[model samples]
Target: MRQKARDLFEKLGYRKIMMAGMLLTGIILYGFLLDSVQSDTYDIQLFQLSQETIRSEKTVEDPVKTELERQRLTEEVAPSYQFMSEIVDNQTALVASIFGYILEVKAPPEQEEDRLTKEEMIEKLREDLRLLETSDNGLRLTDDMLSSLLSLSEARLLNVQKELNNLLESSLNESIRVEEVARYRTEIEQEIRRNETIPNDIIQAAVTIGRFGIIANEVVNEELTAKQVEQIRNSVEPTRILQGQVLVQEGQVIDREVYRQLELAGMTEERLNYKPLLGLFIFVIIAVGLLFIVISRSKKDDEHKITEMLVVMVATSISLILMKLLSAISNNFDLVISFFFPTALAGMLVCLLVNERAAVYVTIFVSAAAGLMLPSGYSATLQVDVAFYILFGGLTAIYLIDRVGGRGRLLHISLAVAFANALFVAFYLLLGQTQYSWSEIAFYFSAAVVSGLLSGALAIGFLPFFESAFGMLSTMRLIELSNPNHPLLKKILMETPGTYHHSLMVANLADASCEAIGANGLLARVGCYYHDIGKTKYPQFFIENQVNIENPHDRLPPEKSRDIILAHGIQGAQMLKKHKMPKEIIDVAAQHHGTSLLKFFYYKAKETNPDVDENTYRYEGPKPQTKEIAIISIADSLEAAVRSMKEPTSEKIKKLVDSIVEDKLKDGQFEECDISLKELKKVKEVMCDTLNGIFHSRIEYPKETN
Candidate 1:
C-alpha cells in the first residue's frame, strides 16, 4: 500500500504534491482553530437570560474592570506641588529696593542741589514707581498702593518695608496657586495687625505692598503630577475571575459586562465571527506561500524537493495539531498546559531531516500557528507572547541540534533546549510584570523545563518515522549504517576481509574528497562501505580478495572475466535492495563504475579475436547521479590505483590521481552529476593529499637493536 502511494506521489510530481500537502495542512489548522465545541459571536443575543450556568474556564483578569479601576485610581491622585522660594526672596528685594530708592530721592544729600517742590517730588516718585511696576518683575501692584508707600515718612516707610519683607518671605515658602495668593495676603495683614509697634496707617501700607509682592510663587508641577498619576494607575491590581467561578447563573439576566465576558470567552453564540478565522486563513496562506517560495528557490532534485516539502508540511501539521490538543487539554482541565506543549519537536525534526534555514521557517510558521491556537480569553498581545515562547524554544533546539552527529547527543541538546525554555519563560514573566508567587513560578519553570526536554524527546522519537517514510538520508541514520557490527558489514568483514579493508580505504578517501568539495561526506563514506558488497559472493575471483592465491581471472576467458567484473555493480545494487537500504547507498553500488570500458579485458579479448564487442566489456551503467556518488566513483578508482603503486611518492600520487580524474572528466563519467570543474579540482587535491599521507614513506625501524 505504501509503495503504491509512493508511485502515485511520483506520478503527481513535486509541485502537485506540495500543493496537496499545503492544502491539507490548511484544512487541519482551520479545523483546529474553529472546532465544533467553540462558540461564535452570532449565536448569543444581548440582554438575554442565560439558559445555562456559565463559569470561568480559566483564571483571567477582566480587562474592562481592570482598566476602569486603574483610571479611577489615577483620577483620585492629587496634583503635585513644587516650591519656588526664590520668588519670595526676589519679590522682597524688589519691594525693599523700591522703597529705599523712594527714600533716597525724597532726602538727597543736604547741600548737594536745590530742593524740588513737594508736587514735583511726588510726581517723580509716582513715575519711578510706575517704571518699577511696569518692568519685567512679576508684581501686581495698584497705583494707589504705590502712592500709599510714597506718602509714608522715611522711618515709617523703613518700618513698613521691613515688616512687608518679613511677611512676604514667610508667606511664599511653599507652592501656592493663583487663588491662594489672596489668602496669604490676608494672613500677612493679620500678622501686621498683631504687631502694635507700627501705626495703623503704616500697617495698612505694609499690608497693601506685601499683598502686591506676594505673587503665586508655588505652581503645579505638571511632569511630576503626571508621573504620580501613572504610578497610581500601575499600582492598581487587575480584577480577576478565578477558574470555575460562576459568571452568569441559569435564568440570570446578562448585563453589559457579562455579555462582554461571554464574548471574550467565545461563549456568546455560534454565529460566524469570520474575523479570527479569516485572520487564520490569511496567516496560513502567507506562511504556506513563503514556504513554497523558499522550497522552489532551493537547489534540489525533483525527488528531494518532493520529500523535503512532504517532511516540512507533515512536521508543521503535527506541531499545530499538538498545540491544538494541548489547548484542548488546557480548556477541559482548567490548566495552563499550553506552556508545556512540545513546540520545538517539529522544528528539531525538520532540522534533522532538512537544513537549518528551512527549519527556521518552519519554526516561524509553527510559532504563529501555536499563537492562533491559544485560549480565546487571551488577548492578542498575550497570544504573541505565547508565540515568542514557542519560537525561542524551537530556535534554541535547532541551533543546539544542528551540529549533532549521533543520537546520544540528543540528551544534551534536550537539556540545553529546556534551559532556553526556562529562560524565556522567566523573561516573559519579568516583561509582563506578572506577580507570581514562588510556587507558581516554580510550576511554570518546571513546565518550561519539561517542554524543552519533551521537544527533544519527541523529535528523537518521530525522526525514524520521517526518515523511513520519506527515505531521508539523515546523518544519524548514516552513522548507524556506518557501524561495522551491522549484518552486511559483519558479513563482508568475516567473508572477505581484504575487500572490507579496501572498502574502508575507499570510504576514507571518498569522505575526505566529499568534504573538500562541500558535499555529504558521511553519506559518501557510508555508501562506500556498502558499495562493493557484491564482491562477497565471489571473493576469490576479485583481485583484492585472492589472499595470496593464483589469480582466478587467469583461468577464465576475457569475456567471462569482464562479465564477472560488471556483475558486481548490478548484483550489489540487487543485494542492497533485498536488505532495504536507502536508495542513495544502492545507487553508489550500481553507478560507481558508470559506462566506462574495461580497458584490460576489452584489449585482451581483441588480441585473440579480430572483432570483439566493446559494449560487452563496459559496465551496466546509469552513471553517478549526485555529487556524493560521483566522488565515490573517483575515490574508489583512485584508492585502488594508488594502493597498487610500488614505492608511491607524493608526486607520483598527485600525477596518478590527476590522471584518473581527468580521464573520468574526458570520458563523461561525471556528466550526469552536478560536480563542477572547480569541485573536481578540489577533489583531486584532497585525494593527492590523503593518498600521500596514507602511503607516505616511513622511517626504517632500528632492526639491529631488535
Candidate 2:
C-alpha cells in the first residue's frame, strides 16, 4: 500500500506528467459539449391574410335579360358602347362582381334622329338620276330648289340648312351644294348605327378569373381597334384585389388558431446527457496516465521531485478555479466576459515556470469548463461559441507571447486576442442566423477589449502567487536581480566587483547565443545572471571573487578542490529553491554544467591518488532540456575560456567556441533533452559571433601613441 501511494505521489509530483493528461481531457470535453448543443432547435411562426378578395359574388335575385332587351337598353341608355371586367390569373382571382363600359363619341340610334349612311342615300339618288336621264326629262333643279327638297325629316332639314349656307358663298353656278354632302353623311351614320352588332362575352368573362379556369389559348391582337383595346384594358384593371391583410372581427376564430400553432412550433427539448459527461471524465483519467508515462521517462534525473509536481498541481487548480468562478459570475451578472478567463495570467504563469506545452494544456482545460457553464440565450449557443473563442484565443496568446521582461509583450498578446475574436464573430455573423442587434454587437466588442485588459490585469495579480508557491525564478525576477541597484546585486558589486562584471558579461554572451539559435534569449540572459549565485556561499573559492589573494585551490587536495568546484552547481540550485525561485531557474542553475569534466582537478587528482575515480570530480546534472539551457551551458564555457586569452584575436575566439562545443558533444553532455547536432552547430556559430563582437580590434589614436 505504501509503495502504491509512493508511486502515485511520484506520478503527480512531476510537472510535465500532469499536464499531459489535463490538456487532452479539456479538449475532448469541449468537443462533447459542442456536439450536444446542436441537438436543440428553436420554434418560430410568421402570419399573413387569406386569399379571397378579387372575384365578384353575384346573386340569382339579379335578373338575366334576353339579348334583344339588352341591346335595346344599350342603344337607349347611352348609344354605342363596350363592356368589360378586371384581370386575374393563377396567383390572384376575382373576389366580387364589378363591371364597366366604354362609350363611343356619337349617341345611340334612338337618340340620334338625323344621321344616315353614304351608301343608302347615294343608291336612292343614283336610281332617281339614272331614270330621269334615260327618259330625256331634262329637269333643272336649282340650288335653292335642291335645298328645299332635302328638308324631308330632321336629318333632311339639317341638309337643307347646309346647302343654303354653302350656295350663298360660292362664285360658280354649278358648284356642288353642301346640302347633298350633308344628306350623304347623315345617311351613312344612320345605316352604321342600325347595323350595330354584339359579339360573345367569352373574352370579357375570362378577365381576372384565376385558379377556377385555365388561361385562354388566344393571344389578343396587336392591331385591335381602339374600342376593342379600350374594352380589354377596362376589363382587367378594376377586377383584381389583394387579400393578405388581417381583419379582426368579433366572430373570427383565426386569432386563437394562429396562437395555438405558434405555441406548438415554439416547443424545444434540448438538454444535457449524462453518458457523454461520464465518458469524457473517463477519457480525462486515461489521458492523464498516458501523459504521466511520457514525461516520467523524460525525467531521468530525479532532483526536487516533490517541488516540481506540487508546482504543476497548484498552478492547474488555481487557473481552473479562477476560470470557473469568473465564467459563472459573468453569466449571472449579464456582463461581458472572455471565454478564456485571465488568459495572460494562465499563459505567463505556465510559460515562466513550466514548459510551453503545459501552459497550452492549462488553456484547454479552462476553455472546457467554460463550455459547461456559459449561459444560454435566444440568439446564442454560448456553449460552443465561447469554447471556440477561448480555445483559439488562448492558442493565439501562447503562439505570440515572448518573455522579454517588459509590459510591451502583453500588448502583442492583446493584439492577438483582438484579431482572433474579430475573426470568430465575423464568421458567426456571416454564416449563421445568430441575430446581431446593436446590444449584441456592443457586447462582442466589449468582451474583446475587456478580455485583453483582464488578461494583463490577472497576470499581474496571479504572478506573485505562482512565483512564491513554486520557489520559481521567472525571467522577470531575474531581470530585476540583474539590475545594478538590486540589494543583493549591489552588495556583490560593492564587496566583489569582479564577479558582478563577470556575470554581466556572461549575461550578454548567453543572450546573444540564445537569440542566434532561436532559443529564449531573455531566459538565457536571466539564467546566466543567477547561475553563479552559489559562489556567494564561499565567495573566496570562486575565481571571480578571489580579488588579488592566493588561489584557494592551491592549499587544498585535488579531491577536495574537485568537490568544492562541483558542489557549487548543486548549491546554487538549493539556494534558489530556498528563496522560492521557480524550478525552471533552478533547472538552469543545476544543469548548466551538465556533468562535464573538471579537467585541472581531475588530472591533478589522478596524478596524486591513482586509485581515485574520475566521476567524483564531475558536476552533477540532468543534461540541458531546452535550447535556452543548452545555449547557457555553451556561453558559460565560452565566456570563461575566451577570458583566459591575453590578446584575443578573431581566430582564437572562433577556435575556442568550436573546441568547447566539440568537446561537450564528444563528452555526451547533450545526449539527453532532445538537443540535436544541428542545434550544437548553431550554438557554435552564435558563440563565435558574440566572441568576435567582444574582441573586435580597435584603431589607436595618434595622441595616445605620442
Tell me, by TM-score, which candidate is best. Answer: 1
Best by lDDT: 1
Model 1 Cα lDDT, one tens digit per residue, 191-276: 87887766665555566566677777867899999999888888888888775567788888888888888766666665565666
RMSD (Å) of each candidate, 1 decimal: 10.0, 18.4
Model 1's alpha-carbon lDDT is 0.80
C-alpha positional error of residue 603 in candidate 2 after TM-score superposition, expressed in Å: 3.0
What residue runs in model 1 are displaced by over 4 Å at the alpha carbon? 1-253, 256-278, 380-382, 402-409, 423-446, 697-706
